[model samples]
Target chain A: MDLKDKLVSSFMAFEDGIDVNDPVHDIRSEAIKNFETKGFPSKKEEAWKYTSLNNLQKIDFSVFPKQESALEYKDIKKYFLHEIDTYKIVFVDGIYSSYLSETTHDGVDVCLMSSALTKPMYRQIIELYFNKIAKKEDSLTSLNTAFSKEGAYIYIPKNKAPRKPIQILHLATGNEASLMLQPRNLIIAEENAEVQVIERHQSLTSNEVFTNSVTEIFAAKDARVDYYKLQNDNANASLIDNTYIDQKDNSVVRVHTFSFGGKLTRNNLNYYQNGERIDSTLKGITILDGKQHVDHYTLVHHAQPNCESHQDYKGIYDGSSTGVFNGKILVDKIAQKTDAFQQNNNVLISDKATLNTKPQLEIFADDVKCSHGCTIGQLDEDALFYLQSRGIPKKEAGALLMYAFANNVLESVRIPELKARVNKLIANKLGVRLGFEL
Target chain B: MLKINDLHAGIEGKKILKGINLEVKPGEVHAIMGPNGSGKSTLASVIAGKEEFEIKKGNIELDGEDIEEMAPEERSHNGIFLSFQYPVEIPGVSVTNFIKTAINESRKAQGLEDMPANEMLKKIREKAELLEIDRKFLSRSLNEGFSGGEKKRNEIFQMAMLEPKLAILDETDSGLDIDALRIVANGVNKLRGSDNAIIVITHYQRLLDYIVPDFVHVLHDGKIVKSGGKELALELEEKGYDWVKQETVA
Candidate 1:
């Protein structure tokens, strides 16, 4: 059977393991109906024009993993921010790994979604904040909402800051030939509270793995959130990440995505500015080669006045790799004085490589400043000659120029350790060792 | 130390340097004076192995080894440096990092380990002092937002750092004031000795006053039309480039 039909039929069996009397089951049941009517997105859709999920649906993926899989700290330590202390919420094969997690309830709640969903003490918070910002109409998001069981659930109460950043890690073992995962995340920062989060989904086996994940973030008045999505999975893995963020008055939120490896990856990041003087920043750096494909689809909705949003994305494609960027900015009639800017720059490393970039702006207000600039070309030949004339080889010279092109967004990273790790990843991806740090 | 024998080159089937021949030994500086578009910069670029120029005939030799087939970096490894007329701006790469990478890559090509940090820093400090450059300028991105004089000064600073055997200054004095010119010339003078050579290519004779050359040649329409001693530069300056152009036609 096709994947959608299989998922639709598996709902009964999926609900059998859980309490069917729970009120949340009603929401899940509603979501499955929505997804059943609208299956996987096709290339005909304007948003999915460049990215197609047809081949992914061809593989018969196991909707539900069998059980828990074990992993030692020594085996997967390289994936975490191990250099510094962090609150870790780790999952293996869609099951929470308490042994590998470093959760805490001291001053804030940095624990499991399952605990927040099944337990009584955390019921009120879940009912209030869960899936409030995630789009209910997007087929993939609705599909994730249908199977949403366990992911990271973070709650920073009013006037409190987390002692350390949080890391939400999901690892998929090759226990099954083909597996599919839907992990839902909810993050809420109350008034004057702050938090930093780093999320990554990794696949350990050479088998095919697909992840359809959704995350909803709420930044209250004067609150701050720094979210990082690092996608460096294996060659057999494919991920579709859908993240939504809502900002309140004077709140600031920033999301940085670094896509280095994967067979096919797509990011649908949306931001809604609900109050005045709010700020939203989205930045990405994608470097791919070897037939890999990465697409970035972003939207910023300005509903209030005096708000600002900035988007800067850079990509480098090589060896027949493909890249797509579709950025949209929508300013409502009342969103006067909105300062929205978007810049997307791409480089094709080979004649076979391809890139498609489209920038959209639908402004209903006259006084707002909304502009976007996009370019897709190869690296500058003159710049390459300049480096080569300085005793750097041709290959290394090209790498240095590309590195400089993509390094502009690294300065916005607030965490020094994460910045350093990403810096190394960029250098490794470019296959050149610089004389020193940029 | 450097020789070019009957070198005829051009770009895109258009001849730029035709049958050019010149030689310079160690401890000597040769000044090539020309009008605009007289192939002075083209000659420097051809010797530095710029692929845009097609060598229709002849070869360039450094220490008696013909380097016609070497890449630009290989030519640089063999001690050939060309200070660009218009230095490119590379954002996000600091000047210190750019020079360090260049030096280390050359060393690595020769199978030598990277220079120690302290030793490299000491060399950088010494060079900065010789050029009278501010310490903060070295930390900024390479040539980004630099004034014309600052760009020229940076080109000279890179020359001081690399210490090439054959340094060709191509219009390095175009955008400099007298004070900057004196500083750049002084740095070049300090870098010269009995073991290296210099080729100064300029349109105006003003820079030749600070960095005097042992020989001077006037080029016209891709060929050297006049060759003389240091007095040749003063003669051309007083009479203008038309003197050589008219003489070539006669």
Candidate 2:
């Protein structure tokens, strides 16, 4: 059977051991039906023009792993921001690895979605916020919802802040021949609360692992939320990340995505300004080579007045790699005095690399300020020569220029250790060691 | 010492520096004064091994070694420095880091280890003080948002740090105020020694009054039409380039 058909037929068996009568089960059934109807998005669609899923769908991806695998903390410790302490919610091949995870309930909920979905004590929150903000019509989102069994579930209480940042890591071992994972995460920062989260999906061996993940974030009044996504999986891994954020009055939410290594990665980031004076910031840095592909599709809906949204994404493509950035801004008729700015800059370091960038702005209100700038070109020859004239070799000079080009998006990274890790990754990706520490 | 023997160069088949010949010995400062578009900058770039200018005839020799085939950085390793008229603004690299990288790369080419951090810091502090640069300015991005005078001063500061054998100051005094001119000239004068040479390429003679040159050459239409003593700069400043252009044409 085809992969979609196999997933559709396996849903019932997937629900056999779990509670079949739960309300989430009905939602899962509805989601599976939606996925079965629409199947997968194709390039004919405007949004999927630059990205294709035909090759991914043809592969016979096993919907589930028969047995869970174990991993040593030392083997994968480099993947985490181990420079500092964090609440970790880790999973191994769709199974929660309690040994590798450090969860907490200290006046907040930093636990698993499986626990929240099955336990009755959390039924109220699960009913109110689960899968509510995510778009129902997105086929890939539906696919994730149909199999959203285990992921991170974080809920910060009102007027409380997490003692440290939280890390949601999904590790896929090559236990199965070819594995497909759909992990769903729900993050809610209550009024007057603050939280930071880092998410990653990693593959252990040189085995094909495709992950379709979904995360929904809600920032209530006066809440602050900072989310960082590190997508540097192995060469055989691919990820499709769909994140939806809903921010309330006086709330601030920032999402920074660093895409350095992966076979293919797609990020569908959406932000909705639900209240006045809300601030939404979306920034990303993508440095890819060796036929790697990354597409960033971002949307910000300014639904209220006096809200602001800033989007800046920089990419450097080398070898035969490809990149796409489609940023959309929607200012409603009532969202006057809204300030929205989007900038996408890309550099093709090799002649064979390709990039497609588009900025779509649909502004209904006349008084709103919506501006976007997109540029695609090679590195500046003059800048390269300038550095070379200063005695830095041409290769190192080009790498330094690229590092500076991509470092602007990292300016607002609040965590110093995370920023340092990204700096090192950028240097490694560019294949040069900077003379000075970044 | 630097030698240019009938060096013919141009960009895109358009001749700029045509049959330019000059010689400079150690401890000598040669000021090349010219009119606008008279190929003074081209000569400086050619000597620094800028590849954009195609040299069709002759060669440039630095201290008896043919450097015409060398790359710009290789020439830099050989102690050739061209202070750009308009230095490129790098947004993220700090002034300290840029100079450190330059110095270390040059040292690496000589098979030397990286300068010790404390020694590097000490040299940077010393050079920065010689240029009257503030500690905060050293940490800012190189030349980004710098005023014209500040950019010239920063270039001089880099020249001091590198301590090249041949320093080509191309229009280094164009953007400077009187105070900045004095500071930059003071820095250059301090760095001058019998083991090195300086080539001052400028249209005006105001800077020559500060860092007095040993010889002055007037270039017109890609050729050195006049060669004389330090009094030539003051004479050119008084009579202007029209007198030289007429002299060359006649």
Residue range B1-250, candidate 1, lDDT tens digits: 8889999999999999999999999999999999998999999889998888999998889999999999999999989999999998887889999999999999999999998999999999999999999999999999999988889889989999999999999999998999999999999999999989999999999999999999999988899999999999999989998888888789
Model 2: CA > 4 A from native: none
Which is the leading candidate under TM-score? Answer: 2
Record all residue pairs in model 1 with backbone atoms less than 3 Å apart, i.e. clashing.
none
Please write out the lDDT profile of model 2 over residues B1-250, one tens digit for every residue.
Answer: 7889998999999999889899999999999999999999888888877778899998888889999989888988889998999999887789999899889988988999999999999999999999999999999989989999999999999999999998999999998999999999999999999999999999999999999999999999999999999999999988989998998778
Candidate 2, residues A331-351: lDDT per residue as tens digits? Answer: 999999999999999999999
As a whole number from 0 to 100, the lDDT of residue A386 in candidate 1 is 81
lDDT of 2 at B153: 95
Model 2 alpha-carbon miss at residue B236, Å: 1.1
Tally clashing residue pairs in candidate 2: 0
